[model samples]
Target chain A: MKKLDNTLIIGIGNNTRQDDGLGWCFLDALVKNGFNEEKLLYKYQLMVEDTDLIAKYKTVFFVDANKTALNEGFLIEKLTPSKKVSFSTHAVPPNQILNLCETIYHKKPTAYLIKIEGYEWDFKIELSKKASENLKNAIKAFIKEF
Target chain B: MNPRKIIIEPVTRVEGHGKVTIKLDENGKVSDAYLHIVEFRGFEKFIQGHPYWEAPVLVQRLCGICPVSHHLAAAKAIDQLVGIDPENLSPTATKLRRLLHYGQVFQSHALHFFYLASPDLLFGINAPAEKRNIVAVASENMELAKKGILMRKFGQEIIKALAGKKIHGILAVPGGVHKTFTKEERAYFLDGIKIPNIDTMIDWSKEIIDFMKNYHLENAQWIDNFAAYPSNHLSLVDKETGALELYNGRLRSVDFEGNELLNIEDIEYRYHFKEAVKPWSYLKFPYMTKYGSANGWNRVGPLARLNTCKYITTPLAEIERRIFKSTTQNKPNNMTMHTHWARLIEMLHCAELMKELLLDNELMATTDLVRKGTPRTKGIGIIEAPRGTLIHEYHTDDKGLITKCNLIVSTTHNNEAMNRGVRVVANEILSEKPEITEPMLNQIEIAIRAYDPCLSCATHALGEMPLIVQLKDYQGNLIDEKIR
Candidate 1:
């Protein structure tokens, strides 16, 4: 945020959960396409303390894979701070993390949830071919928007 | 009048999903209350047919919160496959594993205390939910929050340096580790412990303990007395000197009065323990062998460890340990809520242990990192995780592929206690009212949180849970319901 812009592109998911790794793959494709920036980071999952890290950015694009999102390609939705607060560390959503950012940091960054359709969630590391193709299209569409 | 039931599903503030069920009798007095922990667990059965050596790294996938514990425990169990004499671990290999373990415990303890449990104690459980999270923690005390983040990161740095990655590290192998502690890494941590101005991880942990014991928890303990009940405690201790032993030790069980009940070998755990499966939950209930099911259910984890140990070895943690052992200065600290204090003491001990290992001359030795030997069938490994004693038992064939495996994690060990805690809290709080309140339910969850149950090990339930909770009359008809 301090470098070129206040925007952050973060990919969040487990890399080993087949298409769940779409977040990492999407970021990797962005990097390969020469759309690299210091603001881009990848996390295994959204965490409770991530609010502090998110507060620094003025805008954020959170990329993840959703099995139930639109099957066409990808869906992008604007995010607002939600009042949800989790006592458990495992089930926190990105919007709630932003809500925490708003509550604690007193700054509300513009954020969006970028969800790519995924079919498989097996125990291996490689992405399925269909998932790979969808990732490509999703990245192509997302970059165009950016 | 029909009976009513109140249920809280996915008991928040822990590592995984759980549920608490409270049944009200016709008179509106609390009749039954128990906690059910759920998770997806088949790795033990699924790991069969894989090479014995693969168990160490494979089981690490079970819980992201405690991968290092699994990694080391599996590695140690496989060590027996090669038949390295117990006390004869190659000096170099032993030193490296111990350092890696200390790093694991330090980071994990820091994460649980600063991230998970602190909010409840720092801000009251009844505090506004938005103000009771890490964000608020960061806002209120910027330095403490920042220190927690950095110190937790420092522990992960050690893990990355040794295991290659912070989470699913593929470092520990049977008999030893793959890498040696390099001098450069040691210097980096040594500096991390003390730099910028004059600050150290040890001192930070001490300050946390002091603050918690003296002010934060001291004022709040009155509200969380459900955590202060008596129960049997279990932990691993040095067989000779009876000190708190993390990486390896004999299993010890003590009563509420701190008198030893029994000390057994890890290999003999199967004979001394029994696991029962309740029809309602995915998690199994584990109890001791001699006492039978009625009297055998006991508790493990930080509180148990502190209660079972004769003394802590590190000077800073030892000072805290004496205070923790008996808040009254003469009895075992039975308050489950005080596990937060016990965790900080352990973190302090781990930091001191990490410094001692980092400065040791033999830590950087490149040779003897692994031992070469033939594999044998049936190997057992036991180690103390950040939570409690973790047991990994494997039986293999002549071909070295696993045929059977079983794991008894700390959460499973404390399942009964968690349920009992929920019941105890409900009994203490509930009255003739037919309806239950949200704060009352949250207090029940606080009971389960006291153990920090790791449901990843217990979860084998398929698909996502609809998390439906129903209230029924004594005849079991759906009279009321809540879905979450």
Candidate 2:
């Protein structure tokens, strides 16, 4: 019933792992850019808990890392409610989270999954060289679009 | 009859990477079954050189699902390193940490029982793999799925409000915590975040319990002898009050008969509990000293905590526990499948506890948030992780640089029991004809899923977990596979 009109941008990834934190890097960029209209959230992974917040939003973007094979740099894909949600407490796909918002919360916030490419996701915090460059390109694109 | 093998690799629904392998003998009878944990995170070996205070924050990165557990356990261990007495935790700091733990437990348990475990319990273990998930639940029963998501959001909101983030919030420190609970936070919980949904938040848990109770016969059997094995149980219990303690308490071990085996000091977990590694798994097997490795292994998590505690400190959960225990005739209930119910009850306890903690007037004490003290070289912090008992031990130098660190996570504690459960289910459910139906394969996983092991989903990426059940020939070649 109440709308925040705030486009909820959730950056999801393991920040401690190299390149995996690329999504977090985007959230950092969003904050540093001083773009205040949208609510910025950082989560390690998407969960069932996120749907309520997503329900209040007018639109949502889930920024995450993709293995190189999935996307070489970054790909923004439209999301549909996924009927298949695996039995897990920690992980739910962004589409499924959107589905929960539409199904449970009675609100359908237009949703998109922004997949960033990553080379090394080892137990390190800093992004690898290729991932860093890709992040920069993705940031430039985000700035232009937003 | 040629012996056939059914392998459920990269099992979906649980955390981290683990698989189930069921072997059928020449007579087509169940010969051997094993649940294997394939990944190895050498946190113990790698966290050695970091500063002692960094242990809590560093280990939180281990699991996105239960970072709060690792965070609190590491903080408590570091608290010991800084010489905070178990009996003398700063009142304000203790209460704040308890509130934080409540949020963690609430969110985690809500997520597990409703979203993960209930998918099978409600849908049936024999249900088609493609049709047995929350999406199906949402489509068929939108109300239940809605309640589950919102309830989970409530728990997560509390976590985000206190810890500053949902996944890994660095709020705790050695002597005490980093922040205090402010009015803004209370208002956030009471009005701001949960304004319109308070009624749903409070009422839905009761309805869920009542709904689940409707299927007593079938669900009880689901949790009965097959997956629920009798073994020693371990959890944190108040030394004096004998109540179930999640945040801080003395370690207690009980037999399957609910007899107290040992009342161990938290500092003595290393001396009493021993972990042994097998060649097959990266996870270690933990067993009590008295029973020895061959038999001393015990179950933890909701079932263990529920069975071992004398009384719960909270309200609604306490009532639920009474009914639960009465079902077992007030003795130690060993049914592993009932862990789902126990988790739900604990979650309700957390909600009630949060209501009490948030409304109380005198909960904040920024003055005592951090204590100034000389650091000790070694400290062991223990807490009942939502899954089970989480022990974080760090050895440091006088300068507080970590020399060695050993972590005993929740799932590893149940490793032996999970493997044993697979065998029990295979023995009972698997036929001599090696039928290997989807339900039979599902039953094998049902045994392991009761544990809700954190081993698989620990890495926690956006990677899709397609439910795949693979049937392999004994020669290690894939015979057939079904991806749901």
Once model 2 is optimally superposed onto the true structure by TM-score, how far is the C-alpha of residue A17 displaced, in angstroms? 6.8
Task: Show pairs that collide, candidate 2.
Answer: A87-B13, B15-B456, B15-B457, B16-B455, B16-B456, B16-B457, B16-B458, B17-B456, B28-B432, B228-B336
lDDT of 2 by residue, B1-484 (tens): 6677777777777767787888876687878888888886677878888888888888888887788988988888888788786555777888888888988888787777677777687788778887777777777788788778777777777777778888778788888877888877777677744443444555677777777667666555555666767888889998888788888888888888988887888889888888887877778898887779997888889989988899998777788899989988999988777777787778777777788888776576567677746557888889998889988888998777899888888898988889999988888888575356777777777787778788932322222456577766667677788765
Lowest-sum lDDT 10-residue window in model 1 chain A: A83-92
Interface RMSD per candidate: 3.9, 2.4
Residue-level lDDT tens digits of model 1 in A36-93:
5677888887765566677778899899998885857688899988875544554468
TM-scores of chain B, in order: 0.93, 0.95
- Worst 10 contiguous positions by lDDT, candidate 1 chain B: B460-469
Residue B171 in model 1: lDDT: 76
Assess the local accuracy of residue B40 in candidate 2 as a C-alpha lDDT between 0 and 100: 69
